[model samples]
Target: MNYMDDFPMLNKDIVYFDNGATTLKPKSVIKAMDDYYLNYSSNAHRGDYKISLKVNDAYEGVREKVKKLINAKSSNEIVFTSGSTDSLNMIVYGYFKNKLNKDDEVLVTKSEHASNILPWYELSNEMGININYIPLTENHTVTLDNVIKSITPKTKVISIAHVTNVIGDVRPIKEIIEYAHKNNILVVIDGAQSVGHIKVDVQDMDIDFLAFSAHKMLGPTGVGVLYGKYDLLNELIPTRYGGGMNISFTSKDEIEYKELPYKLEAGTQNIAGVIGLGAAIDYINNVGINNIEETCDSLKEYIISGLKSIPHIKVYNENVEGSIVTFNVKDVFAQDTAIYLDKYNICVRSGSHCAKKLEDELGIKNTCRISIYFYNTKEDADKLINALKNENILEESLGV
Candidate 1:
């Protein structure tokens, strides 16, 4: 099936491969969000009228969609946030600040995105919790053996990406989560890269907390889901407080909060974005995630083979299962190479990709990344490969 028809932005002249940064929104998603503004646009849970009720129901309904998407136990476990960064911060400040002691250790990896790393770094600085990195394998994927070896008595939590944004290797999170639970260590997964591309069952994996952005999965920006176990979510101190989240303000000091998710989702939310997310989910479901995965896997294999034939291109990842390809052109700066590719109307990501610490692990300062989605075709891959095959194109494009 040609998905290019669904995304109006895709064309023969434009080969977009920067899906790891963000995905192009489908027309259905756009229309869903637009429908809200065109017909009924109101603050949810604040009004009693028909339009208000419609808004409220649509907003709350997305929670159910999200609950089903990740196979969460209940809708009460899904809390809407601005994005994965906001969700991770909420986990740190709301839960960890109160639960962890001064000497407690939280294990993370150098390959994690900044959203997953910085929150723990700040928490460590303020609360005196120790920040530890679980050693990564040579291919940059986390292993069960390393996680077991890294755990100490004080290790209270392990935060990692389900798929490293830079390396695109799917981490062995299910095994790690099972082991962490046995040792009483909470596991938090950053699913920004893995969620829409791969099937994730939070309950099946026994994941303690999972955070992901909707935009990365063909949904609207400024909207994301933070899934937590109901018991654990209730234990967290609500990070934000406002009108919608509280039940009563009897006195200046005495205020009663609502329930599990409302307490976390303070103030007005991205109602239209949430609705668009529901539509995006529908589009994904219709297309079938299994098919998407198979398509991307084949495309990745084809791209890797093509890149291997190019002598100047150095592919960074090995045994990579996902659709992302990170590499650098020999003697050419990553940004310059990306700019040269841009001259051919091929879009790709360059630089550290918000995983700055990964540079030391990969032994490089920056790389050019090609992140493919289902919309991308083998023809698109050929365009990129043929562009790189021209050895003098980089310098020619630079006018050097």
Candidate 2:
């Protein structure tokens, strides 16, 4: 079956360019979730009943799927969380609570999404660790030189986004990871915007920890993967504790915890969501991530060229090689531009996009961002540009 054809929202006339925020799910994913609720909707890893066993197996299968998706060393390294935000927080709080001390530093960049930055900031505040910013170049890409200069003996962790959500600049994670590891610093990557859009090999990159949301890859929301090195994960403690993650409990003394992934995942998981994520991974594997990347690259090129041809428009990070295009048109407010484009059945994201610090660093209040996925085509790009060209006329006539 054609994967794009299975998306319910694609049948509508609206052009979807806000894929960075979330993606529309395919029918297979929906069917997978439906099958769970209809047939074997039981709590996972808690009961030995047949339905519960089936749920447990299906839920655990997703761990293997995610490990393969990112080329992780083992399925035991993958932990399920609510989403990227939860995963990042878990790692930050769990690791830093024991690892960092007063005057110790956590290095990050100005281009990070709030999900990656805020958790580290809060950790630093509570633990008395110093948060240091790795400065970006004029083109908005982080350089190894800046990273090298920022690192001091006190730096214990280097947390960064694999790709900037606002500018779409991909980070040099391999180089950064190698550099950090040489200095005995741990690297945590926020992969929320990078995982589905490009090929990611956590083992090859030697990333200590990484987090990505499944919904961004056309899976269900409230489901995400956190991949950590086996040895490192074995050493860290769980930020969340409850059923399904513990080994044994004593009334008077300490409780032993389960190993690796189970130790990190507490309570009842979103079994249906995990099953749907496995299906989504199957769909992506069939389509091929390289093919998806190339398709979006072509669409991004088309969008950047078209937007540049329009008068009084400034595209952010024009040279960056990613599927997103962020820009501001003339004197129009980013929200106003998005509102005007809505009349043409065009959908785009506007405002700070949860990267307020990055926006402030760039000295822009807001921008309109058009993020494309593999299913998008040149026709969508044309519609966006045409609508943008006629935005003023549409706005004036509508008395806006």
Candidate 3:
């Protein structure tokens, strides 16, 4: 039951709790990438020989793996990109920028990550579109009723995170997507924090588009997936063009593009990383995602219960679900608290966490964030709590 053994980094004298930022890669994922470089190292689609064929199979095979992971209607619907930020930009600039017009509205929440918020802001600025906010409930959860009330005739799209990275509120995305569809609005979900942790089905929810990162899901970094409906992807003009994406070119004036998936992939991709993502998915499937989810939930509950006993720690997301806990120690800077914990070899994220605009919403300048995965144990949480309980030690770092 010790999933920690799968991760080579866990062998060190460290407790990695910064999973929300990025997860520790498992040995299976590492071996998958290593096997590619050690055995068949070649570019995909551009070669016809033996090594090239293996690369092509791996490149295309990962697409199918992502399709099954999110339950997309077709393997063609999944497109590989650099990461979630890259995927969201593709949606905003490739699709929405061309489709939307002046005065059109895109509904989003203020609690969204910078990747989700900045792209929409640029779209609105350039296209003369409007970016609107959907009000959160009293507990900061994105409820369906609030979404219903936020809709207007000018609303063309609704973009939000499946789970907010800072607060860890699991939004009612399925119901929101259904409501948006009824109103003829497109829904773009930022699934960076939700996909690997929870069971996500794009087809069952009828999601128009979903973006997630590989590094957050026990996979290698520098790789991500962008899932879209077939018809909608067709409407998106490929932003990057050159190399393998073009089918034929007669001078600069005439060119024919490849089909879906390939058309979006401009150049040689991160072949090793994509292959590693397939291995990560295989590892998750073997362990069972449901089992992982249940384990993480139990650990989060235990951590929250232990944190409550400490009077100095102010815990946010206490009522929210998921494995992320955001809190601050009384009279201690978030970064300083993190440094104190680091002395004990407990790793956590501290800062605005790339969501700078979240300050006004949460009424705090910064927070210490602890995110757990299946590899974590009760001892890890106990060490963190014991560290916080040592006021004499923590106060020393206050001047830091």
Select the stronger candidate by lDDT from 1 and 2: 1
lDDT of each: 0.92, 0.87, 0.90
Better of 2 and 3 by lDDT: 3
- Flag the better candidate by TM-score, 1 or 2: 1
State the weakest 10-residue window (summed lDDT) of model 1.
391-400
Score candidate 3 by TM-score against the native: 0.98
lDDT of 2 by residue, 133-160 (tens): 9988888888889899999999999999
Each prediction's Cα RMSD? 1.1, 1.5, 1.2
Clashes of each: 0, 0, 0
lDDT at position 8, candidate 2 = 86
> What does candidate 3's lDDT look like per residue over 193-306, in tens digits?
998899999999899989999999999889999899999998889989988889999988889999998899898888999999999898888878898899899999999999
User: Looking at model 2, which ten-residue stretch has the lowest summed lDDT?
Assistant: 391-400
Q: For model 1, what is the error of residue 15's alpha carbon versus the real structure, in angstroms, after optimal superposition?
A: 0.5
- The numbered model that scores best in lDDT is 1
Q: Candidate 1 residues 58-91, lDDT tens each?
A: 9999999999989999999999999899999999
